[model samples]
Target: MSTGNTIPISDLITSRPYTSRSFLRECPERDPVQFPALWYYPVQAKAFTICSLCYNTIIHGFESGCGISFGSFTGTKHQTLFCMFGRPHPKYLYKKGDFLALRTFMASRTGLKVTTCHGLGGANANLSTTWYKPRNGEINGMVSCEACYEDYIAHTSFSSRFEKSAPQPAGQVWACDIAVPLIRRTLEACSEGARNDWRVFVAATTHRLKVPACEPYKERAAQSTRWFQPKDSLPGFIICEACYLDRIASTCIQGHFTSTPLSSGQIQHQKSLTCMLSYFPMAIAVQEVIFSENFQLWCEAAKIFMHEELCDGTARKGKSYTLIVKDGTGDADFNICQSCYTCCIDLFGFGSHFKQFDMKTHTEAGIAYSDWACDFYPTRYGFSKYMDALNEAVCVREFSVLGDFIARYQGVTQPCPRSTFVKGRRWYGTSDFSACPDCFEETIQGTALESMIVVRNQFKETECSCDIYSPSMRGIWKNACDTYDYAGFVELVRHRASVYWQTVPVMKRLLSQQRIRLMQQQTLNGSSMLYQRLDMSASASSSINYSGYSQPRYTYGAADVGYGYASTYGIEAARLGQQANNLVQSSRSDTTQVPYLEALWEAVE
Candidate 1:
């Protein structure tokens, strides 16, 4: 065997000096060729150990004077170290007494190689493997994987407090609870105080770990019974107890929120409550509010922001507004709702490109007023592309540069044509309704079940269901794609189609009866005075305010809101028009039927 060239030193030191600050630097990448060595400072009460790589980095930093170095070192060869596999922790420096104890303990055990824990590095633990956990049943939930136990706890005074947990049932997935940030921090604090009391560490972390995971982790665990809402009532803005505790409880604006108990009845009746704070943007906004200590400013800003987020700006009572941008020809117009204009355009410094369109003046000119919708509404397909283009434009500080990208999505309400199927183009979905290459790429291309969908071979003039604006359908597709349940998705689609066809005939008969009744009523009230009274009644009803707002109530039928999929298979234009009236009538009387009807309509349309 040949050894690489090595330099001879006058004196080979067995140990090096390093400080707590020097260990703060990033650890070097692990090299498998070098056996792992554990090194620690002698004076500290820190419970964790650093790997050879980090130990070397700290020494180098000390030698280079890059870090303030102070402390004696004790070194020992270990099979594995936590720093090599777990998240970086500045407090993971070794103590000489603990290191010597760990070395003595390792020496006693012959042929023991605890290389790595199954749950180290944020990975799910293999519960069937040998692992250590708190002996007390109350806090037994806190688990330390085998590698972590050897590296951090086995040599510590509190090692006696933990016992080997029974190998969990095979196929069970469990993450080492000790790896959680809160628990890790608690352990670090315990080490700093040189506290060998296991109860202290357990008491500090038990409640936090016991709190149900934040809203985003709802699937893994149930939410707490309590939730928090803003003191200034903002509809639909709710934060789970867990998120509130973790992110908001200690914040400056914590007083601005009030806790609300979620009863079992309410939980059963309503959809799973989501924590609005879990949204990345909302979380960031809350953090900003915390930093600024301006809850009122956030509240005022949230009125418009939340309104834009919650309301789609369709069929509202108040006067609708639009931002119309004209191309060079002046004939081409791009309409954006006030919400979109304020949030997407003006917020991004692109307001100069658009002019406000006066709906009242336009209607006064005899042009019929149309309900305006934001082009970049959250539910809209290809919204991400618009956002990407906006981001690119912002990055370059040139809005005009991405004109083609903007125009590409504008007025593209129809499905891709057969001519779009050029060579080397990939399509997704079934033959009956396939997504064009562009739509697939924008929406479903990278989804989990992307390969599960059969590629369309026969190029036909079929409508693309991918562009449908129904939230329910999109949600179903998303769930199916996430779980790779292609068969279940197809079954659901077929089931929905069956229900739709069954409802269509019933809807048609109801609409026909309503139309006949209306005609009869008109015939009975043939007098002009009678018509005047009916008009007056309608006007009075419009002025009535059931809610706090004085705006007239406007109801929209399915037909009034075009799904941009009129040409979809098995949907007749006349039948659709008739069903629209029925939908409108049903919506006014029975709001529960609206989602069912909409979902069915979305399935085929």
Candidate 2:
């Protein structure tokens, strides 16, 4: 309902809009709702200045310079923001009020009854209630300001105690948490086949691209139904029109890193999967195979991600992938022992190290260094990274052979369920402790029966361990034999496509968890690969040039480095000490006896 009465709307608004912006050093609340919005306008813009205490009305603005019109003019500086008088909104002129009716009664009353004398007062009881109504009317349903109302409710909402566990007949019990599904969500990772086609994949995990509008600003915000780019091929720079305004107008930097998915004019070709691949560690190493470049600028940047003074190739001797650019001078080449040369070329990516060592005594000094390739090398591995690469290499050969075999044999592939063989039944949720349903039931029954026959048996003494004696567990083994879902996992294992689909997510999770553990370990160990490089540079005074190569003058890991990655690592080390204490305090005899098993489990992850 417009009151049909109005004043020139002051250049202000009542509420603030929230913005999460990066690279915004500071943002002041001053601008109008349009353009860059500010929380408050310096002046109400009514008169030169307005009332500060009650912002609803203007105070004095006659001759003060803050700007604009009318009324008694007092030539004062604009420093006093508000008028000394009471402030009320312009709407006050139109709001109508109602009057109250009279006389509801008010009185003081008392009543009593007789009782037996022994009952303490012939007194049955005496009661009195007092009420005073000077004006004989009722007042109720008074309203409060938004701030005061919020404060009142916040202070009074909980009747008595702080929130904790929900009350139950027992002390407290665990809530039934929502179960996370075992499926992997494949996001808009434009598949390999699509890369060669017109539809280009954009870098978006959260937001989707919307259809492009010729005049985007004139339109109401578009729905995320289509990509802005008209062409099938993705563009080199994938930036949205809206993102540009946010950066330049709103000072937001979030979308600056992302590229616009829409292409202009002719669609640029072949710009897909590369964006997804870039989000990986050693991305350059992976990308180098896709593109023919020996190196890219992005690769060089990533090389220094975790290590400094580290060569792109290797420092050990004998190994060379591509010859170092020698400026056409033969003297640029130097004599590195074969062992050193091999070590140099092999250790390339993150946490990726390799060594050819004497199998009998594989310590640093015992390393073969550059045996190059032993006949046994076909089957032998240098280190874990090398082993993975080698295993992959062998697989490639077998893959080709398998390809030939399949092509000639001409039989349809019976989709094989990978989960059946890739891991134990427990991994697929088919069985616990790697045993099938029947085997597990049989073992538990045997153990329970044999243990029950002993001298201090659970079947006889209440004093016997309740873990083996409890009535709740009495029929558990028998129940397992009858009601277990033996068919559910069996079906999952037999269906190749479904099993592999679920397995992919499980593998991805395991890899992620493993990576986190590795980073934590690297943080704790003072001699991590990155730390090793820093230690070597700690005392080096100056750079040394051998022939054409220039030595490093300073290690980036110096004490004054801006981001000291190692500084917070001590907290993790302290957490590790705490974990050790907890494990020591635990009473599991099996845990104490097989210490290496527990340690290996943590280390492997």
Candidate 3:
């Protein structure tokens, strides 16, 4: 337990009954009362406390021989100090200037101002009045809080470039620009080069920050400006100017790309362009290209990088060939495409686990064909775990170790206990619908419904109608949880289901008829009008909040609706109703339109 002059590990780690009410920023919710905490008071008015783990990790630097000991203080008689670091210690183990050297060394590293005001404890510069910003006064100029300025910039060669600024207005939150990765990288580069030119730094930072964001999967009707596409390779591949500068411009492979021409007129068709370097696997390929300085090799490898597109199982038209798990059964029937196999399996040395599947042959043999979907797609579940397992296998140099992890995903046919519905079992429900264990756990367990869940005993193995995948259901649950309105939640769910069943089919039919008419006309003007109407209808029905999550606008007529739901829903309902009436009237007025109902009746035969 003992390590030289240090305190025994057993003594330091022993559980204690005492608990502190105050919580540190690192562990904001609860105090880990069992471990000892170090409290530092630089002045009588201010105190900062850190748990033992933080003390060892950040302050003590985790050196084995480094230890705290009793020491005498020489400040003031009024200052009732416990330890040299501001805690009390036994006089028997006291040694003169025990922590003086350590404190001085730490102070030199963090700077005198930071040590005096914040001590070894961390500080948030945004809350401090002494934060500094660039003298140029640009709106997007670099700003560093007091702690950051002292700890990172004060000791550097370009320390004098910054000047103290007034604290932000009360209730307004501001963050140190140095916290941004790009800004931090720029600062580091300046430090490494020992560059004291403030103008150059500001210009570089401002220019980089002002560039448009990198959106690889953005679909535009016309060609985009300031974008780079690969020359003579990967036809639809494009990189934003920002991504080009940040990731590829400095590399030797930059010569392989050409600037995409700006659109001269409105384009009739939309094209989705994906940046090759933005995808992780392609980024790795680019890194390889950078190291080898071989652009052609990257082009060959890049052909297999499908930019997360789903494989359609078409040998001639598909971006990549379909790859299925060999001898797979039950849940192990993985339909990974060649792109995913290269990135997730072959790239990690697990190629032997899979093989190419002949989808054409299987279809000809009276088998149903489904489009190949990569189980390890970025957005799919278990993807993170699969990636972690692959990395771990590579790290340990045992490629066969991945087999056990992959086996967990195979040969598992039974639904999870949560998703299963059993007869004579109690389930959470309302009068209209009962949620399976899976649905309850995911959508209702921890919410306001926790107390209000109506337990029901099932008489038969009936399918649970609770659709957790429905965005409307999710939106309703979120709103209900936020407001804690159990009655409103039940009524809303029932109303939504009723309205959806009645409306969706009619809406689909109308949309289909409109699509056929536009196609028959074959005019750009007609297509534009149809798209405009669809956009208007969609916007009127659903509005996305600032957080980028879809906030479904449902029209509920419930009387006891809580927190503005009644008024909001009523207004949205009236608007949607008017739009629906207008659409129906337009369809009726179209004398030249084909009768879709008759067509559907004939096609059914």
Most TM-score-accurate candidate: 3
Q: Which runs in model 2 stand beyond 4 Å of their true positions?
A: 1-274, 277-605
TM-score per prediction, in order, is 0.37, 0.15, 0.42
Q: Clashing residue pairs in candidate 1, if any?
A: 40-94
Residue 585's lDDT within candidate 3 is 58
Alpha-carbon shift of residue 463 in model 2 (angstroms): 45
lDDT of 3 at 445: 49
Where model 3 places Cα greater than 4 Å from the true spot, the runs are 1-132, 138-155, 163-184, 221-225, 230-234, 251-274, 278-284, 287-297, 306-331, 348-350, 360-366, 382-384, 387-404, 409-605
What's the CA error at residue 94 for candidate 2, in Å?
A: 46
Q: On TM-score, who's better, 1 or 3? A: 3
lDDT of each: 0.50, 0.25, 0.48
Residues 87-106 of candidate 1: C-alpha lDDT, one tens digit per residue: 32222323232434433433
Give the C-alpha lDDT of model 2. 0.25
**Tens digits of per-residue lDDT for model 2, 1-605:** 12222221111112222222111111211110111111212222223222222222222332233232233322221112222122111112112111010000000000111100111011111211111111211111111122111112112311121122212233322211100000001111122123321122112211222322223212222232122221223232222343222222122222223334434332343222122111222222232222222223222333332222222223343332222222432111122222122222221221112222232334366655442232111122212223332222222222222222112211111221222332211110112212222222223323423222222100121111111122222244334434553344233224523433354445555555555655555454533444444434442434556798745454333333232222333233344544444433442432343444434322211
Top candidate when judged by lDDT against the true structure: 1
Residue 492 alpha-carbon offset, candidate 3, angstroms: 37
